[model samples]
Each structure stands twice: as structure tokens, then as C-alpha cells.
Target: MAGGAAHRRPLAGALAALAALSACSLFVGVGALSPRMLLDEPDAVALMLASRLPRTLAVLLAGSGLAIAGLVMQTMARNRFVEPSTAGTMQGAALGILLVTILAPGASILAKAAAATATALATTSLFLAMIHRLPPTQPFLVPLFGLVYGGVIGAGVTYVAWQADLLQLIEIWLNGEFSGVLRGRYELLWLTAACVALTWWVADRLTIMSLGREASVGLGVDYAGMLRVGLVIVSGVSALTVVVVGAIPFVGLVVPALVSRLAGDNLRSTIPLVGLCGAMLVLVCDMAGRLLRYPYEIPVGTVLGVVGALAFLAILHAGPRHG
Candidate 1:
């Protein structure tokens, strides 16, 4: 009971902090909003509903989805460092977006999202295949290989964008920001919520798969099928995030690492906490971006990159256990 209380305390604290940050996010913008204004001013109400509310929702959904995606990837790959951005999934999505832009200039948003999801899945599969080819003892090599593979994919996308005069569009996708997330604009991110729920439902299978193929098979688990499903979840979340708010790096990588440190690796128990921690991290970063320049804003992706890189380095320095 004491141990349970201890666990709930931190979860409660995180939730409280998230709620406070969310409230601040709703009120802290160029157009000031206050309790009084919400009741008295029509513009305040409209802005809150149309912009601030959507942005906050986007932050929560994107953060939670990416963090869950990271946990899934880490468990499946049995590597702590591997996540969507580092594993080329984001770049693949970018390539998909670029292809859609060039090939079907009039493509609908759903079509673009489908293309991105397909490409992300393909690239993630390639990364997994490469990992399978290498010795299992050198787990670090997987993330390193993913970094290089993603860079190659990114370079290809950049070259194509440059040639096609679509660099601006690609740039927007690369630098993730929620400033553009108004009501209709950010509805796609709700898909991430559904994905996260689906992931939660399969947490037990994922946990089993993380125990390695022999262990999974010993327990009568279909290791290959579970791996495929995990990959699909990661790819879908990554592609949706890229298509909706651009590539917000490091949330997946950093949030899961932090959550594991606080809550341990029991995915069934920790998935909710992982989602909350991820949402909190992104919310804090987004708030910081808004405050940094007042009227102007730094991209949330930029803030998270600097912060996530530092945290990632610290994790590396600590030499996380593979377990």
C-alpha cells in the first residue's frame, strides 16, 4: 500500500503540473485572456476555443503519442535510444509528404497522411531488418545505423525538395510548431489519441516481446506478429505527428527514458505515466517557446531539440542499462 501510494504521488504531481501548464498555455498569448475576459469579451472566447484550446490539445496528443511510440520502439528493439526521429521514421514521412506534393499536387490531407504512414512503415522495417543482420550483442549499433539511415533519407528528401522548389513546405514540416494549430487545422492529431489507446491495449504483448524472441516463444507469444504490430503503431504515430505538427524530435526518446527512470520498465503499469510525462515535457517546451519572444515564437521542435539533446547526452553519460 505504501509503495502504491508512493507511485500515485508522483503521477498525481505530474498531472497537477500538466493541468497548471495547460491553463497557462490557454492564457499566455499575444491576445491576453483572463477569467473576466472569458466571460465579458467575445474575442477572448473565440480565440480560446479556436486557437488556444486546439494548440493545447495538439501538444498533449502529440507528446503522448510520440512518447508511447518511443516506448514501443525501445521495447521491440530492446534498445533505449531508438525512437521515430532517430530511426528514420520521421524522414520517411517527410519523403512521403514531398512525393505527394510533387506527384499529386492536389492530393487531400488524408492521402498525404497515408503516403507518409506507408513510407514511415517501410523505413522502420528497413531499420529493423538492418538490426536483425547485425550481432545482437551490439545494441548501440542499431540507433547509430538508424541515425545514418535517416540522414541519408533526409538528404534525399532535401535534394528533391530543392529541385522541385518545395523547400519552404519541407522546412515547415521539419521545424515543428503548434502556433498554426487552430480548431480545424489540428483535428488530425486526435488520431494520435486513438493510436495511444490501441497501444495501451496491447501493452502486455509488447512487454512479452521485449523479453526477447526465445522468451516470447517460450511463453507462446508470436514474436514476429507482435513486432510487426509494434512497428505499425510507431510508424502510424510518427507519420501522423509529422503530417500534423511537423517533426518534434526527442519527446519520444527523452520522455520514455525519463519515465523509465521514475517508473521502471513495466510497460503495462508505466504506459500511462509515460504518456503524461511526455505531455508535460512538450507543454513546458511549448510554453517556453511562447514566452521567449512574446509576440513571436520559437518552434517547439527547436526548444525540444536543444533540451532533448542535452537530456540524451546525460542519458548516454549515465550509460543506461539495456535490461
Candidate 2:
């Protein structure tokens, strides 16, 4: 009972902090809709509804969803260094988006996202299949192979985009930013959030899944089914984020890895923390992007790229720890 209470306290505090950040996010744009103006000014209400609220929500959903995907990838692969970006998921999604642009220039965002999701799933499945063959004793090999594989897939995407005259268009999906997010535009991210939430229901099964297939079956877990579910969740989340706000790289890798250090890998207990921590980290990065250049803004992906790289190096310096 005491242990549960202790855990709840940190979650509570994190939630409170997120609430504060969300409020701050509401007022951070160049248009400057102050809290005082919101009480009486009609334009403030319009700005809040049309722009601020949606951007905040998109940021929250993307951050949390990416983190959850990363955790699921780590669990399934039993590797700390793998996530959507490192595992070919994002590259696959980008290819899908490019092909859709070439084949269906007038496609809706939903169609593009659908295509991206399908390709992302295929690529992630391919990566997993390749990783599964490597000796489990050599943990470093999984992420290394994943990196090489993702690079090959990414190269294919780049070459095809160049051939099709879609390099500029592809560039938009390559780096994630939320400046254009509006109420109607960013709603699809809710689907990603939903997929992540669903994982909580089967958290125990996933925990057992990390033990590998034969062992998972011995422990009464349906390893193949869970792996499929994880892949779908990871691919869907990655594709949706790419489609909606471009790719928020490394949120998945950075957040889950750090959270596991504190909360350990019991998904039931750590899932909430992982999501909250990810949201917080991303919100901070988004705000920094807005503030660092003042009126001008940087992409959240660019901000996170630098930050994630540093964090990635730090994590590596700390040495690889099993999830």
C-alpha cells in the first residue's frame, strides 16, 4: 500500500507540472493571447481554440505516443537503443508519404497516413525479423543491425524522392514541428494516443514478452500476438506523428530509456510515468524552440535532434542497461 502511494505521488506531481506547462503553452505564441485577455476578449478565445489548444494537444499526444512506442520497441526487441527512428519505422513512413505524393498528389492526410502506417509496419516487421536471428547474448548487435537496416531503407526513400522530384515535400515530413497545427488538422494524433493507451491493458503480457518467444510461451504469454500488437502500435504512432507534425525524433528513445532507469520495466507501473515524462520533455523542447529565436521558431525535431543527440550520448556513456 505504501509503495503504491509513493508511486502515485510522483505521478501526481508530474501531472500537475504538465498542467502548468500546458497552460504556459497556451500563451507562448507570437500572437500573445494573455490569460487576462482570455476572460473577455473574443479573439483570445478564437486563438485558443484554433491554434494554441490544438498545438498543445498535438505536442502532448506526439510526445507521449512516441515514448510509449519506444518502450514497446525496447520491450519487444529487448534492446535499449531501438525506437521508431532507429528501427526503420520513420523511414518507412517517409517512403509511404513520398509514394503517396507521387501516385496520389491530391490525397488527403488520412490516405497519406494510411500509406505511411502500412509501410512503417512492413519495415518494422523486417527489422524485427532480422534482429531475431542475431545471437541474443550479443546485445549490441540488435541496435547496430537495426541502424544499418534503417539506413538502407532511408537511403531508398531518399533516392526515390529525388527521382520523383519530391525531395522538398519529403523534407517537411523529415523534421517534426507543430507551428501549423490547428484544431482540425492535428486531431489524428488522438488515434496514436489511443493505441498507446490500449497497451496498458496488456502491459503484463508485454512484460513477459521481453523474455523472448519460447520462454514467453512457457510462461503462458502469446508472444507472436503481442509482437504484432506492439508493431502495429509503434508503426501507427510513428506514421501518424510523421503525417501530422513531421517526425519528432528521439522522444521515444530518450524518454523511455530514462524512465526505465527510475521506475524499472514493470509496464503497469512505469507506463504512466513514461508518457508523462515524455510529454514534459517534449513540451519543454517545443517552448525552447519558440523562445530561443524569439519571434522566429525552430522545428521541434531540430531542437530535439540536438537535445536527443546529447541525451543519447549521455545514455551511452552511462552504459547500456536492460529494460
Candidate 3:
């Protein structure tokens, strides 16, 4: 109770900062719009509505979705270091997207998202089964196998992309960048928002399932059923995020972990906060990418990739201390 009370002010401050940063994000793009004219000028209104609004929405949805997915992945794996990336889920989704591009060239965005989600869920289930079969004492083996598995799939996709003569397009698909987002193209992210809502709805069940399969079953929960539901939701969210903002690696891993640190591991209470933190991180990184180079823009994905890698190392160094 005392801890939750202490977090109130800090959490409020974080929310305000995120909201302010997201507002600024709407005006910081490569356009002539000014904050003052956001509502008054027709041209500014048009640009804000047609471009910035949807982009902003996409950022929120995708950020929240990935954060929730990370939260679930870490909880289920019982390892703070684990996430969709470490579990081979995102790699599987990427491979699915690549396969779609090859098999059904010029497929609709919805089709691609569906393929990615299905592949991610399937791969995560396989990884989980493999890990579950291992002795409980050998916990590290699961993540190690997952890491190597994801690497192999990633390498395979890269090779295929190189051979397809569509390497550039495929590369663009994985490189997290929100710059290319526009009204029609970004509607796909709404699916991510929907997934976030669903996560909240199932938050309590997920929390119980995270307690270990035996505990969950002991508590009258359908352990396998709950796990599948959680993973499917996570995969769908992650895949849509990848489709929208490319791969903002570690947002899911970092944001939810940070939230759990400050707010405790109550998934029911932490969902929105994780989302806000994720949005703030991406918004900050995106602005930094734009401002650092001025005329020469660096993609938000690249900046995040570099920063995420450093953060991942820091988390590794910090070890279970942070957890």
C-alpha cells in the first residue's frame, strides 16, 4: 500500500511526460505545421489529420501492444530477460512476412499481418514445448535455444531476401521506421490496439498462468488454454507492431520490466503504464533521430536498434538485480 502510494506521484509524472512528448511528436515531423496552427490552419489540420494523427495513433497502439507482449513473454518464461525476440517469436513472424512477399507478391497488408501473427504464435508454441520438456533446473537452456533458433531463422530470411532481388523491400520491412506511415497504410495498427484491450481483459488469468503451469492448473485454470490465449494475443500484437513500425527491438522487454520494477508485477495495474512508457521511449527516440541529423533523417528503428542493444547489454550486466 505504501509503495503503491509512493508510485502515484512518479507514475503521474511519467504519464504527463509521455502525453507531452506524444503531443510534440505530432508537430515534430518534416512538415510546415506549427503547434499553434494545429487546429486553426486548414493545411496544418489536413497534414495533422492525414499524417501525424494516424502515425501518432500507430505509435501508441504498436508501442502498447509490444510492451504487453513483452510483459506476457517475460512472465510466462519466468525470466526478465526473455521477450518475443529472445523466444524466436518475432523472427518467426518476419519469416512469415517474407514468405508472404514471395508467395503472394503484392498481398494486402491484412494478409501479411495474418501470416505474421500465425507464424509467430506457431513458433512460440514450439519453443515453449521444447523448453517445457527440459528439466526445470535447466532454465537457461530455454532462452539459449530460443536465441539460437531466432538467429537461424533470421539468417535464413536474410539469405532469401538477398536472392529474391526484393532485398531492399524486405530489408525495409524489418528496419523499424515510422516515417513512411500515412493514413491508408497505417490502419493496420488498429489491430494492435484491439489486442492491447484484450490483454487487459485477460490480465488476471495471465498473471495466474505466469505462476507456473502446475500452480495455474491447481488454481482451476486451464493452464494450456490460458497459455495459448496469451501467446496468440502477444503474437498478433507483435506482428502488427512489426508491420507498422518495423522492429523496435527491446521496447517490449525494457518497458514492461521497467514498469514492473517501479510499480510491481501486477499485470492488471501495469498494462497502461507500460504502454505509456513504451510510447514515450519511441517518441523520444524518434525526435532524437529527426533532430540529430536535421536534413538527413535517421530512421527511428535504427536509433532504437542501437539504443536497445546497449540497453539489453546493460540489463544483462545488471542481471537479476534489476528484476
Candidate 4:
């Protein structure tokens, strides 16, 4: 009972913080939104419904999805640093988007997302294959190789976009801003909500797979099948996020690591907290971006990239002993 109480307190605190930040997100934009206006002004009602609500929802959904993706990657790779960006999934999605823009300029949003998902799956599979070849004693090599792989892919994307004169569109997709997310523009993020639900459903199987292939197979788990499922989930979530809000780096890496620190690695219990913390982090970053320049807005991706980098460094310094 005492241990349970201790666990509940942090979970409760995280949820509370998430709630507060979400509320602030709804009210902190450039628009003049106030309690009084929400009740009295029709334009305010429309604005709140059309822009504020959707932006807030998008942040929450994207944050949760990315964080969960990170957890899934770490589990599959058996490496803490192997999040979407580090694992080349984001670059794969970027490459897919660039390809579609170049090949089918008039492609629908769904088609673009499909292309991105396919590329993300392929890239993630390559990462897994590379990791399999490396000695397990050198865990750091996996992420280092992933970074190089992703960098190469990113460079290719840049070259292609430059040649095609689609650099500006790719820039917007890479920067990951939520300022332009109105209702219709952001509804695709709802797909991430379904992805999160699917993650919850498979949480137990993933936890088993994290014990390594030999151990998982010994336990009668379908190791190969589960790996494919995990990759699909990670690819779908990463691709959808890139499609909807661009790539918000480190949410996946940082949030899951933090949740594991607090709650241990029983993912069934911790995934919810991971999702909540991820949502809170992004909401806080998004709110900070809105307020930083008063009238002008900074992109959430830029803010989180700086903040997440610092946090990532700290996590590295702390080492696994602390975690």
C-alpha cells in the first residue's frame, strides 16, 4: 500500500501538470481569448473552437504519439537512445514526403502519409537489421550508427528538395510549428489517438520482447511477429506525426526515459504516465513558444529541440546507474 501510494503521487502530479499546461495552451495564442470573450463574443467562440481547441488537441496527440513511438523503438532496439529521430524514422518520413511532393504534387494528404509510413517502415527495419549485426555489448553503437544513417538520409532529402525547388515546403515540415493548426488542418492527428490506443493494447507483448529475442521466444512469445508489429506501430505513429505537425524531436526519447525513471519499466502501468508527461512537455514548450515573442511565434519543434537536447545530455551524463 505504501509503495502504491508513492507511485500514485507522481502519476497524479504529472496528470495535474498536464491539465494545467493544456489549459494554458488553449488561452496563450496571439488571439484575444479571455473568459469573458468566450462567453460573450460569437467570434471568440468560433476562434476558440476552430483554432485554440484544435491546436491544443494536436499538441497533446502528437506529444503522446511521439513519446510512445520512442518507447516502442527503445524496446525493439534494446537501446534507450533509439527514438524516431535517432533511428532514421523521421528522416524516412521526410524522404517520403519529399518524394511524393516531387512525384505527385497533387497527392492527397492520406497518400502522402501512406508514402511516409512505407518509408519509415523500411528505414526502421534497416536500423533493426544493423543493430542485430552489432554486438550487444556496444549499445552506444546502435544510436551512433542510427544518427549517421539518419543524417545521410536527411542530406539526401535536402538535396532532392533543393533540386525540385520544394525546399520551402520541406522547411515547414521539418520545423514543426503548431501556430497554423486550425480545426480542419489538424484533424489528422486524431489518427495518433488510435495509435496510442493500439500501443496500450500491445504493451504487454512489447514488454516481453524487450527481454531480447532468445528470452522472448523461450517464453513462447512470437518474437518475429511482435517485432514486425512494433515496427509497424512505430512507423505509423512517426509518419502520422510528421504528416500532421512535422517532427518534434526528443519527445519520444526524453519522455519515455523519464517515465521509466519514475515508474520503472512495467510499460502497462507506465505508458499512460509517459503519454501524460509527453503531452505536458509539448504543451509547455508550445505555450512558451507562443509567449516568447508576444506577437510572433516560435516553432514548438525548435524550442523542444533545444530543451530536449539539454535533457538528453543530462540523461547521458547521469548514465544507466541513475535511471
Candidate 5:
């Protein structure tokens, strides 16, 4: 009982911090708007509705969704370092987006998203098939293979973009930013948010699946179907995020690894904390990007890349120690 209370306390604290940061996020952009202006200035309210609110919501949804998706990927692969960005999922989505942009420039956002999601799903499935063939004794090989696989896919995408002269546009998808998120721009992330909830509902089966495929089948958890579900969630979330805000790497890799240290592998309770930390990490980075440059803005993806890269190395150094 006391242990449960202790756990709840940190979650509650994280929730409070996220709420506070979200409020500050609204006031950071170049426009002169604030909570004070909303009472009397119609423009402030319109600006709030049109831009600030949507951006904040996008950050929350994308961050939380990615974190949950990462957790699901880790649970399925039984590898801490494997996630969308490392597993070719994001690269495949980038490929789909590039193809649509080149072949059907007139495609609607939904069509483009569909293509990206399809390719991302395919890539994730292929990665899983490859992982299945590898011996489980060397778990580290999964991540090493994923990194090489994703790099190859990413290189191909870059080459295509260069040949097509879409390299500049593709950069936006490579490094995520929330500046373009307005009222109508980011609603698709809601679907991924719903996916996160579904993950929570099936969290127990996922935890059991983490033990291994044989163990999951022995426990009557329908391992194949659940693996597909997790793949879809991971792919959908990764594709939508790239389509909307671009690829923000290492959220999946770092957040879950850190969360595991604090909470162990019982995803039912830890998922919420993971989601909260993800949201806070992105929000804080976004805010820093705004303040560090004053009038100009750095992409949140750049800030996170710097931070996530350092964290990634730290995780690499410490992983064997933990194991």
C-alpha cells in the first residue's frame, strides 16, 4: 500500500509539471498574447484558438503517443533500444511521403498519411521477421541490426529526395517541429492518442508478451495478433508524427529506458509516467528553443536531437551495467 502511494506521488507531480509547462508554452511564440490579453483582446483569443492551443495539444499528443508506442515496441521486441526511428519505420514513412509528393502532388493530407502508415507498417513487419530469425541469446544484436537497417532505408529516402529536388521539403519531415501546428493541421494525432489508450487496456497482455513468444503463447495471450496490434500502433504513431511534425528521434529509445529503471516492466502503471515524461521532455525542449533565440526559433527536433543523442550514448554506456 505504501509503495503504491509512493508511485502515485511521482506521477501526480509529473502531471502538475506538465500542466504548468503547457501554460507557459502558450506565451512563448513571437505573437504578443497572454492570459491577460484574452479577457479584452479578441485577437489574442483568436490567436490562442488558431495557433497556441493547437500547438500545445499537438505536442502533448505526439509526445505521449510516441512514448507509448516506444514502450509497446520495446515490449514486443524485448529490446530497449528498438523503436520506430531505429527500426526503419520512420524512414519508410518518409519514403512513402516522398513518393506521394513526387507522383501525386495533389494528394490530400489523408492520402499521404495513408501511404506513409502503410509503408511504415510494412517496414516494421519486416524488421520483426528479421528479429524472429535471430537467436535470442544475443539481445543486443536486435538494436544493432535495426540501426543499420534504418540507416540504409533513410539513406535511400535521402537519395530519392535529392534526385527529385524534394530534399528541402524532406528535411522538414526528418527534423520534427511543432511551429506549423494550427487548428486544422494536427487532428490526425488524435487517432494515435486513442491508440495509446487501447495500449493501456491491453497492457497486461503486452507485459506477458515481453517474456517471449513461447511464454506468451503458453499463457494464452494470442501472441501473433497482439504483435500485429503493437506493430500497427507503432507504425501509425510514427508515420502520423512524421507527416505532421516530422521525425523526432530518441523519444522512444530514451524515455522508456529511463521509465523502466524507475518503474520496472509492469507497463500498466509505468505507461502513464512514460507518457508524462515524454510530454514534458518535448515541451521543455520546445520552450527552450523559443527562449534561447528570442525572436527566432530553433526546431524542437534539433534541441531534442542534441539532448537525445547524449542520452542515447549514456544509455549505451549504462545498459550492460543494468542488465
Candidate 6:
């Protein structure tokens, strides 16, 4: 009982801080709508509800989904340095998108999203299998290999785009952006919320799998089934995020990391907290982008890329004790 109380206190504090962050996210933007307008003007209300609201929601979903994806990847791979982006998953999807543009210029958005996601999942699975065969003495080798693989894919995409005279278009797809997100186009991001819920429902199995294949099998858990399901979830979240918001990089790596530090890594215990942390991190970055530019807009992806990189390096320097 006392232990529960001790845990609850810090947890409550973190939740409160997170809620405050969410509220701050609401007032962020360069538009004419002020806090007073949020309450006073109909036009302001419409703009707030239509543009900023959806954008905020999109940021939240992308951040939380990416963060959770990172958590799952780290736990499953038993490597703190590995993330979906670093593991060549997102890069593969980006390469897939470039291919689609070359081969099927008229492909529907749905078709492109599906193809990119399928390719990402397949590549991730292949990378993992290859990692399993590598010498165990070099534990970090696989993630490095994944990075090299992603770089190669990214280079290929860039080269193709240059040759095809679509470099500018490809550049837009390469970096993530949230400035253009509005009510209709941004709702697709809500799919990430659904993904988060699914993760919660399967939290127990994931927890079991995190202990390792031998331990999971000893406990009668179907390791292969659980793994395949997790991979699908990762691919869907990564691809959908890219499709909607253009590929915000480090949300996945940083959010889960911060949550794991504060709340511990138990699936059920840390899920919502991790999600909230992700939302807050992205929200803060998005707001910074909006406020710093005034009339002009900076992409949330760019801000996150800079911020997430710093945060990730900090985590790496902090070492694995917290994780």
C-alpha cells in the first residue's frame, strides 16, 4: 500500500505537468487568434477548431505513436540505440514512396501508403533476421548496419529524384511538415491513436516478449506471433505518420526514453505516460516553430529534428542506467 502511494505521487505530478503542457499547446501559433479570441470571436473559434486543433492533434498522435514505436523496438531488439528510423524502416518507406512516384505517378494516396508500409515491414523483418545471425560480441552492430542501410536508401531516393527532375518534390516528402495540416487532411493522424490503443490491449504479450524468446516460450507465449503483430504495428504507425506528417524523426526515440526514465518500462504502467510525454514534446516543438517565425511557418518536422537530435544525444550520454 505504501509503495503504491509513493508511486502514485510522482505519477500524479508527471500527469499534471503533462496536462499543463497540453494546455500550452492550444495557445501556440502565429495566427491572429489570441487566447481572448479563443473565447470571444466566432471566426477565431472556427480557425482555432479547424486549423490549430487538428494540427495539435496531429502532433500529439505522431509524437505518441513514434515514441511508443521506439519503446517497442528497443525492448524487442534489446538495444537501446535502435529506433524505427535508425533501423531502416522509415527510410525503406521513403524509398518505397520514391519508387511509387517513379512507377505510378497517379497512384492513389491509399495505395502509396499501403505499398510504403508493406515495404517497411519487410525490410525491418529482414534486418532483424540478419542481425540474429551476426556475432553476438558486437551488439550495437545491427543498429549501425540499419543506419547504413537507411542512408543508402535515402541516397538512392535522392539520386532518383534528382535524375527525374523531382528533387524539390522529394525534398518536401523527405522532411516532415505540419504547417499545411488542416481539418480534412490531418484527420488521418488519428489513426495513430487507434494504434496506441491496440498497443495497450496487447501490452501483456509485449511485456512477455521483452523478456526474450526463451523466457517467453518457457511461459507459453507465442513469441513469433507476438513479434509479427508488433512489427505490423510499428510499420503501420511509421508509414501512416509519414503519409500524414512527412516523417517527424525522433519522437519515437525520445518520448519512450523519457517515460521509461520517469515511470519504468512496464507496458501497462508506462504506456499512457509515454504517450503523453510524446505529445508534450511534439507540442512544445510545434509551438516553437510557430512562434519563432511569426507570419512565416517552420515545419514541425524540422524543429523536432533539431530538438529530438539533442534530446537523443543527451539520452545516449546519460547512458543505459535509466533505460
TM for every model, in the order presented, reads: 0.97, 0.97, 0.92, 0.96, 0.96, 0.91
lDDT of 3 by residue, 1-323 (tens): 12365656766887899888888888876787787896688888889988888887777777777888888888777767778877888888887888898999889888999999999898888877777676656655666787898788778878988888777765676677777888898888888778888888888888888777888888998987888788888799878877666777788888877777777777877777887788788778877887788756788778878887788777666667633
List candidate 5 stretches off by more than 4 Å: 1-3, 321-323
Whole-model lDDT values for every prediction = 0.89, 0.90, 0.79, 0.87, 0.89, 0.78
Pairs in clash, predicted candidate 2: none
Q: Write the per-residue lDDT of candidate 6 for residues 28-86, one digit (tens) a residue.
A: 76667678886788989998888877887788788888888887877777666677888
- What TM-score would candidate 3 get against the native? 0.92
Cα displacement (Å) at residue 104, model 4: 1.2
Say which candidate scores most in lDDT. Answer: 2
TM-score winner, 2 or 5: 2
Report the C-alpha lDDT of model 2 over 3-78, residue by residue, as the tens digit.
2875788899999999999999999989978989999899999999999999999999999999999999999888
In order of lDDT, best first, we have 2, 5, 1, 4, 3, 6
Give the alpha carbon lDDT tens digit for every residue of 1-323 in model 4: 12366577888988888888888778887778987898899999999999999999999999988999899999898888779998899989988988998899999989989999999999999989987898787767877898899899888899999999989888877778898898899887888888889888888888889887899989899999999988888999889888888988999999998788767777788888888888888888998898999889999999999999999998887776622
- TM-score: model 4 vs. ground truth: 0.96
Model 4 poorest 10 in a row by lDDT: 1-10
Per-residue lDDT tens digits for candidate 1, residues 99-198, read 9999999998888989999999999998887877877777678778889999999999999999999999988888799999999988888888888998
Task: Assess the local accuracy of residue 156 in candidate 4 as a C-alpha lDDT between 0 and 100.
Answer: 88
The stretch of ten residues in a row with the least summed lDDT in candidate 3 is 1-10
Q: What is the lDDT of residue 23 in candidate 5?
A: 95
Model 5, range 224-314, lDDT digits (tens) per residue?
Answer: 9999889888999999999999998888888999999877888878988999998898888888888899888899899999998899889
Report, for all candidates in order, the number of backbone clashes: 0, 0, 0, 0, 0, 2
